[model samples]
Target: MTNMSAAAAGPNATYNFKVVLLGEGCVGKTSLLLRYIEDKFNDKHLTTLQATFLNKKININGKRINLAIWDTAGQEKFHALGPIYYRNSNGAILVYDITDEDSFGKVKNWVKELRKMLGSEIVLIIAGNKIDLEHERTVPLEEAESYANMVGAKHFYTSAKLNQGVEELFLELTQEMVERFEQNSQTDLNRTQRVLVVDDEAPVQSSCCTGSKTN
Candidate 1:
């Protein structure tokens, strides 16, 4: 659970964090992850047997952050196994297909269970995936944004096919996680200055496909 600590030691420290993706089957959780981590997406739908794992590294404001991402099986049968993968997660990405209203409801369930287990210790990021199919969108932008706000989760629209909002989604999540982690352990002298600077940065806003952010 070391990585789940979200710890970044004194000077030149690297923040290590664990992230997991959860949602109903075929919600494009895998596709969105592929787009973020590998910058590749397969048009063909491939069923995930159990789970997939990947690592991503990014530098933010002179601080190094490493993310261990766990892509879990979205099948209902695997619902009981959710705790196994998300147990020590520092952050979670709950994805729901924009075309499937049921998937969005399921994401709410995941949020409940996650809060029961991890409380507010874990960061939450919700994504309304498949923006390319906006014409067929059943999930209203207002509803998604409202729900995200209600649950204290940042929301964004992502399209794996168009590679839209993918980078922004991850970047925002990473920045938020780093800020939270830094605040939790700001007792170190070296981190004091970094914390002050982070506090003055603009508050992250929900992003749309055009990279536009909302207040």
Candidate 2:
């Protein structure tokens, strides 16, 4: 956990986290993000460029959480740029088209890369998107859930077209992030207290050493 991504605690942001969305092209990553960020969706296929950045503020448990979200281009040619976007990200959402098995396969590769770069401390969410097309689904729900469990991620079935499960997914993610932030904050406080205790005892130890020298 030494290299864990730290949530930003700033004047304007009570708790700030960077979140990255990863998946193969046409997996509804952008759609899911748009639905979450703006509650809006387009039926037309939207291709991101290098990436798109957005800042969202939400209040969870009476504390404001600022989310820095980055939606990256999912095209094969832009795959190399993934690291640049996901580096130091506190959370990642791996979106897969439930109708496309290959999209789910690509999500696995993305998951491997994210864990390699960000490690286990980074919150991971696996989204089986396009559930509105359930009739066309090729990715089994059990399989996705099992894989998510194996990797310590939460799995969700989402449909941006129907605006279903989008809000719930973000709410779950926000709560998890808030819990992590509180835990991290407590750890830091404990570490600081330990250091202060050591510092206060330093002079006493030095005085005892001086007395020993005099004797």
Candidate 3:
């Protein structure tokens, strides 16, 4: 177990993490990213460039993770740039507009492309946005959740406009990433203490000698 008192007394260090946002055009990918980055909502329908990059820092489990958030352009024309952003990303957030049925329909394609481009080790999350406009919602939560489950991704319904579940989703992802890091760290730590026997005796004893053993 990590010592809570030591963590509180130690100097905080920033651990770099990469995260990307993906979805079809007009799926509120930019909106959610902007809301998370700037804490301001803009309903403007501006097209994102090849990519939108943002830097953010989050504290998870008493450790700081400096996130390099890549918000990819959702236009079909910019599809060529998708691989560049997805490559080496620690996690991905796949957004779909709840009100736009077409956008919702493209979720599977986006997830497939992410798996193809980023590999299966990356953390994947499906975000259903525009939930504030319930009357305009075309994608049901159950269906979205079902698809997310099929892809083995976390599912979340968020309304960037209403500021609902946006922070919680980021926090959840941060915790997930941190938990994964901690698990890997522990695995590495466990691997470091290999038992080896060293004998200063003759060549005959060297062969039979057992190295240092762990406590």
Using lDDT as the measure, the top candidate is 1
Instruction: Quote the lDDT for 8 in model 3.
Output: 24
Task: Give candidate 3's total backbone clashes.
Answer: 4
Using TM-score as the yardstick, the better of models 1 and 2 is 2
Q: What is the C-alpha local distance difference test score of candidate 2?
A: 0.85
Whole-model alpha-carbon lDDT for candidate 1: 0.87
Each model's lDDT comes to: 0.87, 0.85, 0.78
- lDDT accuracy of residue 31 in candidate 1: 92
User: Please, what are the lDDT tens digits per residue for candidate 1 over residues 50-86?
Assistant: 7888999999888888899999999989989999899
Candidate 3 accuracy as TM-score: 0.80
lDDT of 2 at 211: 36
lDDT of 2 by residue, 1-215 (tens): 31233344544447778888999889898998898888899999999999998988888756777888899999999999998899888888899999999999999999998888767768889999999899998998899999999999999999999999898887887778767766877878899999998987745443344435542
Q: Is candidate 1 or candidate 3 better by lDDT?
A: 1
Model 2, residue 86: displacement in angstroms?
Answer: 0.7
What TM-score do all the candidates reach, one by one? 0.83, 0.86, 0.80
Worst 10 residues of 2 by lDDT: 1-10
**What does the lDDT read for residue 29 in candidate 1?**
86
lDDT by residue (tens digit), candidate 3, 1-215: 11111122245855677888988988788888888888988878857888978999777666877888888889888988888777777788888888888887777887887787666657788898888888988887788899888888999999988888898888887777666655656665566543222343345544554686868
Candidate 1 regions off by >4 Å? 1-9, 187-215
